[model samples]
Every structure is written in structure tokens, then in C-alpha cells.
Target chain A: MAEIVGAYFTSHVPSIGGAIHRGLKQDPYWKPFFDGFPPVHEWLAKVKPDVAVVFSNDHGLNFFLDKMPTFAVGAAPEYANADEGWGLPLYKTFKGHPELSWHIIEGLVEEEFDPVTCQSMLVDHAISIPFELAYPDAEQWPIKLVPIGINTVQHPLPSAKRCLALGRSVHKALASWKGDERIVVIGTGGLSHQLDGERAGFMNAEYDRFCLDNLVSDPDALTKDSIHEIVRLAGTQGVEVLNWIAARGALGPGAREIHRNYHLPISNTAAATVLYEPA
Target chain B: MPSELEPIPGTTLFDGEAARKGYALNALCFSFNEKVNRDAFLADEAAYLARFNLTPEQHEAIAKRDVLGMIAAGGNIYYLAKLAGIFGLNVQDVGSMQTGVSVDKFKAMLLAQGRGESYEVAHKEMLNG
Candidate 1:
């Protein structure tokens, strides 16, 4: 049976790929942002894990305006790339675990989170971009993945509290799994940014820092904010932070912070990622 | 700019903006404003929702908006209208009820309001003063 070795929380901004790989960090506006991190390539090479349970929200692919699941997990042998109408890259599909995925689905449901399971699914930048950062060489990814997708685009989204609660439940599940392999759960999204309407390019670093602080030290406080208020405070994209709630939740109120960093540059937004280990 | 407007009043479960976007999207896609198609859709409704690529969120939004006696407090007009057709009614039936019209008679008046002319229809089912 697999046990969760640790959890990862990250920002899945599309621009990071440009900075880390192509040296988009050289661009005047993009340079300062990438400067904060100490060589992402070097970092990923070190903190390798066996499998990752990735959390992300879809951006108009697979699911559409007609129907969107609140939380959906894929149990396929692998998931393919998302087109997203923006000509997304066509990458190798992610491998999934139906038995484990169903077990998670049932456990989450029993814990009061209605997570849906899919046999096959495609992932968007929210998941794919981060995967690239962690697994620069796709074929040699150290971690097999349990991709948990959320509905951040459609509104009245799950409250940050509820998302956090779901994470806690997932942690309980890992303990019960009885698997032998070590697991790493990852949550991906924002640290304060919006991508719509008059408030389109909104950013609030102070709030981002506060959020990161609470995420590692005192996550219970995060449960206080409603999804609406969070969205209002952080901006539309900021709500994606709810994804991180899962990473925090997996630690079950007692985890040590492994690494943390924050930056704001070209996209005119704040981004951060935190690593945690169970107590 | 309905997207910019306030949420559909009393829509508590789903995202108001997406709900609103969904309404306009519904109108654009299905155009339930036409009587014949509306009737046809509502006529075999169960088989209908199954055909499209409606997300669970959109399906929930439609469910909340289309429940009986509830006001169409949502943005997706096309599905809402299709729902009205399922009940053998229209926006007039909805509006007339607001003005104290009976649903049964609202059905009758709508049928008599000339074939396929949805925009012009009014509720003769108004309650007796």
C-alpha cells in the first residue's frame, strides 16, 4: 500500500515554462520574476518522489459551459494534452489508477466530498504546465500521478474551507490505502491574480503572503474565508488557491514546511509554491 | 453586458457569473425562443440533456432555475425556455404568474396566441380581479 511521503503546493502560471526553459526570464518584464527562484531545473532534479496526486482546475476543455463537475479525478492509465482552443501542446497522456482512483472517490464521498471519477481525461495548463516544471523530461517522470481536477472556472465554486476539508479527508484515505509506494500530493493554482472583466489583471501580494503563511503554520484560518470572499479578495484566478487547500489538507493539521518562495514579475501577478512533510 | 450585471437574484448554489454566461450561451446555442423547437425539446426533454456536452455545473444551474414555482433566476435562457416549453408554457406563462395568472389557463392562452409567435404572446390566464 502507498503512503503519502509529502505534499506540494504550487502556482501553475503558463509563463513559468517560458522563463525556466526558453529563458523567457531574460525578457525585461519576465526576468525579475524568474530571478526569485533558485534554478527550478536544479530543484526538481533533487526533490524527486514516486507518484503525485495533482490538483488543478479545467479551462474550457473536456468540460464546457453546459456542465462542470465540482471535483473530478482521472483513473486512466494516462491522460492526454488539452487543446483549450489556444493550441495547447500535445503531450503524452498521464497514467491513472482506477482501483485507487475509485477507492479515493469512495473514500472522499464517504468523507462528504462528492468527487467524480473518470476513466479517461485530458488535462489543461493548470496541471500540464506544472507537470513540465516538476518532470522536465516527460518520459522519465519520477512520479506516477493521480490527477484531481477542480471546477474553478464555473462559479459558486467550492469554498476554500470545503476544499481544505477535502484535502484532510484525502489524507485520511492515504493512511487507509495499505499501499507500499510513497506518495506525493500536489495542489496547483494561484497566489493572487484574476483573469476576467474590468478586474482582469488584479494582484495582491500582501494577501498572497498572508495566505502562504497560514497555509503552512495555521491552515485552520484558511477555512474561514468563503470562496466568494476569496475570489473577491484575490481576484478570479486567486480562487485557484483552493487547490492548495488539498495539499495542506493532506498533512492533517501537522506538517513541516520544506520549501517556500514567492515572486511577481511579467504577468503582473504573484506566484508561490510550498512544500510540506507530515509530522 | 449581462456578464457585468449582478447575479440572478436568489441563485445561491452556483457561480452567478458563469450562470449568467450560461444563459446567453443557451440562447445562442439552442434558441428555445422559437415555439416549435421549444415544444419539441420540452416534449422529449429526458433524451435532450443527454445529447449535449453539458457540464455538471451547468446541469445543476439549470436544475435550480427550472424547478417548479421557482422564478427563472438564472442566465441560461435557452434551457430555461426549453424547460418552460416542457411544462407546455412560455415566458408569458412565467410573467403572467408574476402578475397573478394561473398556469393551466396560461397554457391555454399560449396555445391560442397564434402559432409559433412566442414574443407576441401574453397571459390570458391572469387571475380574476
Candidate 2:
């Protein structure tokens, strides 16, 4: 059976990509955000996950509103990063674990969750930035990937409760899969910062601290708030915390927080990173 | 029947209504993902925007570089971001434009929030007033 190694949750602010490209990791503006990744890197060196299952939201790169999926999974042999209209450089293509992806897809259907399965999915900054942060200097990514995209851009998005259930179902699928691959689940985006509207520069540190504490101690509590409430408390784009909540669900109960770092204003985002190991 | 969604002040939920209204405008912004399209749009902004057949409000909003006006015209921020990029405006620049603050002050507000200052309350009060 496949071994679920751990989970990582982080913000995937696009400017981090530019900062990385411009070699500004040590610059004062970016240092704190960049500093959060080293501990995760050290842990990754030790655990050496063979496959990564990423839960992230797309930002109009792959799916436009014309045909948006509530939840989409990638079963392609490879996934590429493309231009996101802003100035972030394109990232390296990621190898996919199609076999595992299919298994999970089948399992999700069996468990009564419908997800659009993509043979070819273009991952945006939400996946690439976190992956780059995790493996800063990998010439070729060491692990195969299974990219799962959740709808965050459009309204009427899947509820926080539904996202949690999806993650739990994925956990069941991973556990049942007949493989020995050590898998790491990653949830990327948000620690509270809104862009758009009169509330554009909103960042809620109090709410973010509440979420960070609850993500480890009581994820379900975080889900109790309605999406509108979440937006009010966390900011509009800050609702990307749904990704983190879902990823936490995959880790199951008693997933200990190995490390966490929270920093503010990483390109209009309250950036954060948390690593979790299952009990 | 689904219950009505309460409005969040200073926030526009990109729900179905906005999505429908913003489709043409957003599609135009989405086209910016390609370098050819971006260059074309940059070379002739009016012509490029017209190609999408955006609503008059959207067209005017883009012409005026009005972030708030664009939102009121149903421009989703995610897509509007691509449009902002063409103007070399990052989120802070957009925020500053929307809130009538300088970019530095906008950034400072964010830093203050991160450092545990409560601008959200003040901003909310301003919005309510």
C-alpha cells in the first residue's frame, strides 16, 4: 500500500515567483516569506517523498469561467506551467503519476464526489510557486505529481465542508492504492489578504492566527464558517484557505504540526507555510 | 431553495451574476496570457478591447484605469489582474488606485495589518459611513 508521508500548506503568491527570478530571496522585503521554506526543505530531504498530490486553485490560466470544474484532477503524464498574463516567468514542467491519479479519480467517484479529470492540465502559480519554494534548486523535479484544482476564482465555489470531504476521500483512495510510493499532499494559497473591491489591501492577522491554530488543532471548526463569512473575516482572495483545510483533511485526525511560519504582505497576501505529519 | 447571500461591504462576490456580466471583459483580459495578444492589446487598447465586445461600462472603466469602476462593471479581480499587469500595476498599485492612497501607503497599511494593527475596523467603518 502507498504510504502517506505528510502534508504541506503554503501561500502561492505570484510575486514570489518574480522575487525568485530576480534573486531577491535574501532581500528584506522577501526574506521572511522565503525563510519559511528551509525547514520544510530539510524535512523533505529526510522523508524523500516519491510522489506529491497538490491541491490548489487555478487563476484563469487553465480554466476560464466558460467551463470551470468545481474540482478537477490531472491524470496526464506531465503538467506544464504557462504564462499567467502577469510577468511571472514560466516554470519547469512536472511529471505526473497517471496511475495513482486514475486510482484516486475512481475512488473519488466511488465515494460519491464528482471531479473533472483532465488528461492535460496547465498548472498556474498556485502549484508552481509552492513547488519552487519547496524545492528551490531542483534541476528536474524528483517526484511525480498529481495536481488537483479546486475552484476559487468563481463564486458558488465548493463549500469548505465539501472540500474537506474531498480531501478525506482522497486519503482513503491513497491508502487503498496498491503502490509503495511515499506520497506527500500539499495545499497551497492564503493566510488572509484580499485583492479587488474597496477592501483590496485587507489582511486579517487575527483571523489568520485563529486559522493557523485551528488548522492543526481543529480543522472542522474552521469549516463551520460560511464562505461569505470566510470572505468577510479572511478577505476575498483569502478564502484560498479552503485549499489548506482540504489538505489538512487528507492528513486525517491527529496530524501533528511539524513546523509553521507566517509572514505578511507577500504581494498583497498574508503568506504562511505549515508542515504536518500524521499520527 | 438556496438562501440569499449577504453582501460583504467593500467586497464583490464573483458569483453567477458578476460572472455573466464580466464574461466578455474577462475574456479580453484572459487573452493577455499570450505575448502576441498582450502586444496587440498594448499596441491598440481600444481595438483590442472592442474585439471582446465588452459593455460600455467595462470599456470606459478600462479606459479610465478605474479599479473600482471596473469592479462595479463586473470585472473579477482574478481576470482584472491580467489587465492591470498590462499597465504595469501590481495589486498594491491597484489597491492604491481603488482606495485613493499612494502605493507606499497602501503597502504600509498591509505591513501594519501583518504587525497586528487593526486597519480592517477603520476601513470597515469608512465603508459603512
Best by TM-score: 2
> lDDT tens string, model 2, B40-127?
9889877877788789898888889898888888788999899899888898899989888777777777776666768666454434
lDDT of 2: 0.89
Candidate 1 lDDT over A1-279, as tens digits, reads 776667777677755654556646567655554444455445545655667778788755556565679888787887777433222344456666666677778789898787778887877667777777566666755567788887776665777777888888877877788667678888988877643332333456567777888887788787786666676667666778888886788766688886776765234246776677777
TM-score of chain B of each: 0.36, 0.89
State the lDDT of candidate 2 residue by residue for A39-80, as single tens digits. Answer: 999999999999999999999999998999999999999999
- What is the Cα-based lDDT of residue B110 in candidate 1? 34
Error of 1 at B47 (Å): 28
> Each candidate: how many clashes?
23, 0
Cα distance off (Å), candidate 1, residue A197: 1.8
lDDT, candidate 1, at B70: 26
Residues B1-129, model 1: lDDT tens digits: 223434312222236654654554353234443455545555775466566556565566555543322223333322343444445544444434334445554444333322222212322122331
